[model samples]
Target chain A: MKLPSLRIYAFAYLAFLYAPILLLPIFAFNDGTIIAFPLKGFTLDWFSQMFANDTLGRAVRNSMIIAGSTAVLATAFGIFAARAGTRFSFPGKGPIMGLIMLPLVLPEIMIGGSLLLVLLAIGIELSILTVILGHVLIATPYTIAILNTAFASLDRSLEEAAYDLGEGKLSTFRLITLPLVLPGIISSMLIAFTISLDEFIIAFFLAGNEPTLPTYIFSQLRFPKQIPMIMALGTCLVLLSIILLTIAEYVRRRGLKKTGAKDTGGFL
Target chain B: MRRSTASWGFWKTLRATSRSELPKKAPRAEKWRRAMHLASFQFPLPVLSSAMLRKRAAPQETRMAQGSPLSRLKHSEAANGLALISPTALYAILLLAAPLLTILAYSFFKDGYLTVIHEVTFENYKAVWTDPIFRAILLRSLIVSGLVTLVTVALAFPIAYFLSFHVRPDRKSLWLFLITIPFWTSYLIRVFLWKVILGYNGVINSGLKSIGLIGEGQLIEDPLQMLNTVGAIAATLAHAYAPFAILPIFVALEKIDRSLLEAGQDLGESRVMTFLRVTLPLAMPGVVAAVLIVFIPTIGDYVTPELIGGGKLPMVANMIQAQLLPLDNKPMGSAIAVSAMAVVALISLAFVFANRRYLRGPK
Candidate 1:
């Protein structure tokens, strides 16, 4: 734990974590098809190739569609569940909340497998729709947990004032509650979208013929040569996830500061 | 002088002997009842905490409220709360609960080649035990997961310790950001990268050879032998679960009271002994949490093993996936799913039990 040793250990750990990531962009820009060292001359040909593939483009489009839908649906549900747990008094409330959060601890395989069985029983064939439904189930709990604090911190009187003005619940929520907690809502949506986008095992089980990006990436890696492209895709995903997570952290911190709950919640 | 000194020494002797009382043992049923009670108690704490929070927070409530006091918002607040969470509730019912229900029903059925016949039977469970491969892979999955848990926790502890205790303010986030590297990319790509690194004529052997570390022709090929070995699988899995291990340990470290460490030093323990006696014991919760996080998921991991194992090994996950996807044997697959879930549920229960007793708080 000496300062120098700690520094070395910290940097080495970082190198181990990030060296492969560093390799991705390097190879992505390499003009040569090979992805070995003794650096190939730099070029963006592979990125250009990425644009030419219609199927890849379509997959991206489909992924965007699914990610967006999952985010909105999951966030909407999260806000409700979070509110119920935070503000309401009802019987069986704890069990219900535990059930909502149950998927968090349960294996994704179990959830996915069980959902597959249920979907088949209902004659719902796997598709992007099915994938979206599954994503929503897993993502909702996280959304709810994150939004719970935001909902908890909201000055309830804002909604109360709207109600006293004779506004209905829906309108009050739309106008007062929604606007004040918008930062949390946005954070929940971003995280949910990223979870849906990068999610694989669930998407693999649910996305029958219509593959999402992760599934597409899975299939592409079956051949050794396609790995470089996968690395390129991974680099893009890594960059995207970092941006998404950073924005999520920023918005969440801002929301916490806004509500004056910044120092607590103990590691989030 | 003699009388006073004798009295003081006698009192000290009495105190030392009195301190060693035999610990009381609760009856088995008593312990069980208390556990059930404690878990039940925890069930409402979150709800109650938020409510009691309302009272303590009254001052801020008035400042933030539009017109009336903050507590007045409760009448309309509950309604708005329900509205916000409806989508999450609806999706959970349709996708998660419904699918799990179907599996429960299917677990009772029989499959014939292409069709699933609906008749309640435990034959699938019986068949699950009879299958040798199922037994082997289940055990293998457990072993692999145990290795992954052990390795990742061991590796993550030092880095987490560095971040939590050793680092300056400016560097904490950077180290955490670095630790998050494993999580940022497609998991499949990382698996494939290890495939190259561990493959015959891959980097490890070839690089070793150029440096005269190993002779030529000693390059590690025969991927059928090496790729899917437990070692390879665990290495890849360790990387995946590292972030999971880091998060909880980091949290636990941050929660460590600095005064306790200073107390240990004030007691004249050396640095290493202070860490062993003081810091390690307190971080036990994080270690247990790390195991739970890493072990549970690693056991269910089919993708990493499947991609990297090259058909040599099949974890329970791969088996479950195959049964449902390609083989189209839904009943058996659902059975596999149930079996796997049964194991996870049991471990989780034990984890809760341990958390209550050893870590949450003093009795």
Candidate 2:
């Protein structure tokens, strides 16, 4: 068809994708109890109420802890897997990597349900720690995908030269390989943090009586009075996600440049 | 070609270093150099051409004969690789594989009063398959996911095509970044926002009422009643999965050689015909991928149904959740989970098989 029509269609599709999210800030600032039309003059009461809520505060704290721990653990595991898969030949590599990536396609409900059963069967109490375990399992695949590119694009001669200069394997890796993939590591951590922060299903199933940000939002969604504050919270989360993703994309591109590799694509 | 040049530089440096530092152990150093060469050659980089792989394999047999089995096992690259990957592997086995197995095993076991019994039986699966409620929910889940996949992939194709074919190369990444931003945001919030837009007395209804379209006793008696419907659920899921559908199609389109399109035109095919015969077929693999990527996840989506459907239209996920948690029927829930997964896997495999011609290796 015509290019102009196609362009309009693209823009309209984007609007559809973004319309609900854009409505968040609009309703968040509206000075009204109920979420409806015909603009109720602008106000920041929701934001203030969101700030002053103690449960919301606790939920935010809980989410930060879970996200932070998930980021570190997932990224560390990603580094190990990425380094091994990219740099060495081994038996069962296909199946091993496949198993690691299985969570990507598996349903979140399945993962959450299965994990809940296993944890209960093993006598482990559902808590933020259990949520972390689920989050890390899901997040590690993404980190591995990102880090694999970072590790694969590296110049093998750089490491070989360090080894030839009498550096031990561990020292050579620590000094050379670590710095080269540092940006990728940072990108992976940020993405993992974002995933854990936004995750709902697993956290809902695993976090027993604990209020992570998503579960809190899910609970308050049913209340009309709490909807506006939830919108305010949603606005903040959308902004935070955008910021984190932008940084991740920037660092990923910068890493590609530093390694003198071509940019294929990124999470963005 | 670049790899060969790099390898040349590496060998030259290695030989120069060994000659200068270890003159007395030249033979041993030569053996080490050969072993290093074999090590490097064994796992060629991802970008290696088949010709390069064949050339690199010539000296592997000699290297394998030079070392004792135990000593080689200790020094082998496989040993190092396995050691490095052990932690991640163990974690996956313990958490992912073990849990999945537990779910599978539970599907066969019987549920007891507030607890699962150790006795194994097929009662849960029998119930899941025989129960009309379970069957209807599973069917609805399939229909919703299929609708989502179709709508998402169809809408995404035009945009992905525009970006790949019409947009400037310099601005493609900007378009992609814009497309993906919504997908990265909080999914719970996104689903909730849909409720605000589609709920009774929501933005559309209230806006219509203010404009004198919908009212108590005007042109319409009640609101549009958009929420708690299958259409709303499909629309929400379609929006959520749009970027995923776009990316793969865009990648496939980007891989298409422009010269082929020109060649098709030169062969007297019309623009529409060229697109239909050449572009569409070539993009099938991506379309298939987009289908699976969108279809599989939406089947398991919990938030969209719960929020948009208002708990009135419970999909398989909700059914499983109800059985497992509120009803405390572990065996039934596990059976439902396994059954849903089996259906998804079968459908995905069928799709891939149907499209195997397009997905075959490039000539």
Candidate 3:
């Protein structure tokens, strides 16, 4: 309760969170090869090398491909499911919806292991495609859960008005509902994107031979000198994730406000 | 830890008990419906229609059982929901169940060198349960993770509380966003940073020595026993799982009515006392949820423990992974997986119970 203690503890914890992240750019700009914090002159060589290195380049490209595919696939499933869940008074809805949300609670290792078994059983090659499928399955639940409130918040009267002018269900959904929930859709997509990009266990098992960014990082840790470059990459990723997730939290709040749902969670 | 508990099969039986509503909806189609029910294909669409019929006839049930609509809705669509949710239900069932079943079967089978010939034997569990290494590792994991969860929650609570209660409303949104930013970054990167900073030529070692706080380079390669010990493992895991812990706690704290805390203060309680009595009680569910969020995942988490626990402390998950892969010992691995699941399931059940109790109790 004391102001001084609060300030001290808060500062210490914040430093704990930020200090390692701050090191990323420092060593990244260092003229010397070592990462330890002695005075090293500045250099952009590592950043330049980060751009030029063939393996890192391939890994980054692969990561982009995987992450992008994962985001789209996850969001698409989320949309249909969320629509069904929010609008219709359907049978077995609660249980079906719960089933969709199971992956959010179930252990990732179990999911990853089973997926690996099935992929192996069916003789599907371990590749980005399989990884995308697994990510979509896991990430869709989160996408749907977040978007459920968004879709549910929209007034059915608006859709009925569209219907009054002779608009069909599909047309009314497009013209009226889609515009109302676009921000929610966008936020869900970004959240799904962030989740997919950072996911490891499924990617680890299903990634066959083509490595992802996380996988690449995992392999690089086996070598000592690569730690600095990894830190640089990590620093960039931390900034990027923070930015995207911030946007997600913002859009989530904005979407809720736009649709006028009482903020149970508000922004956070 | 071998928990054999199963779902209520409650859904399956619910349909069988609710035959009264079926006749009213499909008086003409009763035969086909009955046959379908017999076949156990009482799927989703039928269930929905049945639910509609049930809702229409709800007055009678309301008078009879004195139940809420939500509870009645359970019986009407129980079979159909189960059938409709079958694909996903089955997916989870197969995905989680099969490997665990494999583990259970293997735990009963003897471990072999190259070829894992499946013969039923209980010797593996007997051997594993008695081993000192297993006992030590298991205890070490529990103690370290318990400490980590405590520390993480203790550390995260105030920040979450501040961001929720004290920060300006405008800045509150972005600050919450900043809290989750670390989550999206590579966990390996953060753990490795700790490694570098704590190493001999690393930041802490050289910086300390230079400042005359300790002798030269004693920090780094001098076996870093402390750096990579249980302490580092706990630190890294707490760091990784803090966001998870904080989110729930923040949710709990944010959802608390501010007036109540003020009311406590108005009634002559100090701020700290008010927090302990009112705000903290209201946030108990969140605190429990936070603990579970950190604790459940921390159990199977091999990543942080592997990186930071160094070689001295191989957690259960690491041992299981070792067996499943290079060791070619599926049986032992399955046993480990099953046991770990048992531990997780127990914790998860307790967490749910605690959450329910807290939500319903005095606060």
Candidate 4:
């Protein structure tokens, strides 16, 4: 009962944080079309409608493709930058890293607008590929942030030991360094995938005719009839995100334990 | 120098002699010196001897004894690091830096019928600055973001304090995970859900009616009009960014030395006074960071204002989007974007400068 007021306040704040998201499932299964309150019988019609919509399917497929490609590409780039950043001291390192992490602070609208202008001027077609390009630009910073921890916590002597045992640099990296940071790499990819999947502004501007999940949801939000289906979709997305983030947190913690590094908290 | 020709006994002898001669250092340094010795022995060269091995093993001596600056640069660790990071650095420069510079350039150019004229002019900036609608939206964006930042950081501090100080260490990550779950979900959906909850016949109204709080004959004539207002926009943003605010403050609170508070108490100060004098000051950096994190992004938030405000109350972001896409005025959009960014940067820099005292010193 100590600090009862503060504890109650904290719980209330958590409730506020979760209230809207907790509404997703309630409306998703509601037997009525409207999202208002009342005792309506439970039904799964929204879920069925969400699954049967061909456009929703297309958007899902497109989002998965974009998220997958972005995760891999951003994580690959992250590995290079993170390894170099942690293992070696270079000239202009600060500014180089700053430029790479700039997207973290810059507004997405600015990034989206600027990139759109450049793509148009260059005569490039807008597609999921361009969306991937934009996603990689933003997601690489997060990946690098994750991988930096992974690389920094590593014992350098392990790689040197492999080299001393007559292994080449590439083999030393492949055998000694890869296994140690594999958990971190997975964590980075999952986070990057989640970011790309949930992203709306960049995809809206970049995906000319294609429908990603967020943009599709945005489009559907305009129609009153699509509310329940969108709610169902939101429930599924929220569930998927929770799963991904859980796995990411688990892998990151495991990586910390494997490296014998102190737990400094994680992305979650 | 070939590894095939070297014997274990010879290597052992070499290590013994070098270890005896070299000054004592940390074990890691000793290991590094051994690795350097091993590397020199692995070099493919003729006429290798223990003297050459000793000379090569002492990297500082050999580095000082090397040739020209360009040749030195070729083999320098900086060069290797640069080479390794080139792929990522190149992508950033091409994608992020180039596009940003293009936006800056486009902002100054003349807007043609459909095509952007290459002629550089300040008319776009002039128009953007002088427009009443742009000014109103920009001001609204600033006010809404500031309000959200204030509310979010205030609300987050106590929770962050609870997590950092009151919670058991073993369960902190679980608490953090739970807090961040809603943040990672689809933002568009979250914003839309706010509209569903706050609309005229939304959850609150219906719930109130069901409980007999409001109806046709009740004191209140109509369901509360919550949507299409700045307060609704701010509330939605504050909810979305709560975790963003909590994390920084929690980190700052975690870094404080517990002994400081105990020492303050030992000096005869009450708990409240000790907290006011010791803990709050130490947590200011996190507060400032949380402020910037919440404020910067929320000002540019396009979804919340569009959905919660029902597109009737457009922020700067909506204005920019309108100009760029719907209206096809690239120069004007670019100008507004640049102006908004400049204002945001100025405000952020000023805030940082004012709070620079707390930001200094080792974490």
Q: What TM-score against the true chain A does chain A of each candidate get?
A: 0.88, 0.96, 0.88, 0.97
Error of 3 at A194 (Å): 2.3
**What DockQ results do all the predictions give, each relative to the true complex?**
0.29, 0.54, 0.27, 0.50
* Residues B177-295, model 1: lDDT tens digits: 55764674567667767776676655555456555556645543332235768899998888877788887788777778999999999999998999999898788777887788788
All candidates' TM-scores? 0.81, 0.89, 0.80, 0.89
Local accuracy of candidate 1 as per-residue lDDT tens digits, A1-268: 5667876876787777765556677667766655554455878767766667676777788789999999998888877776666555333344456566667656788788887777776687778898887888878877876786687677765677898999997888888878778889998898888888888888888888886888888887677666666666777887888788778767876776786654332113
Model 4 chain B: weakest 10-residue lDDT segment is: B1-10
Among these predicted structures, which one has the highest DockQ?
2
User: RMSD of each candidate?
Assistant: 11.4, 6.1, 8.5, 9.2
Kindly indicate the candidate among 2 and 3 with the higher TM-score: 2
lDDT of 4 by residue, B170-274 (tens): 788888888988888898988898899999989999999888887889867689999999999999999999998998889889989999999999999999999
Per-residue lDDT of model 2, residues B1-363, tens digit only: 112222333333334434544444447655765665555455433233223323432333235435776776666656777788999999999999999999999999888897789898988888889999889899999999999999999999999899989887767777888898898899999888888888898999999999999876799988998999999999999988899899878877888999999999999999999999999988887788788878888999999999999998999999989988899899899999999999999999999899988875355
For all candidates, the clash counts are 9, 0, 3, 0
- State each model's CA lDDT, in order: 0.71, 0.85, 0.68, 0.86
CA lDDT, candidate 2, residue A30:
94
Q: Which predicted model would earn the best lDDT?
A: 4
Model 4's lDDT to the true fold? Answer: 0.86
Candidate 1 interface RMSD after superposing interface residues: 11.7
| Alpha carbon lDDT at B356, candidate 4 | 83
User: Candidate 1 - CAPRI tier?
Assistant: acceptable
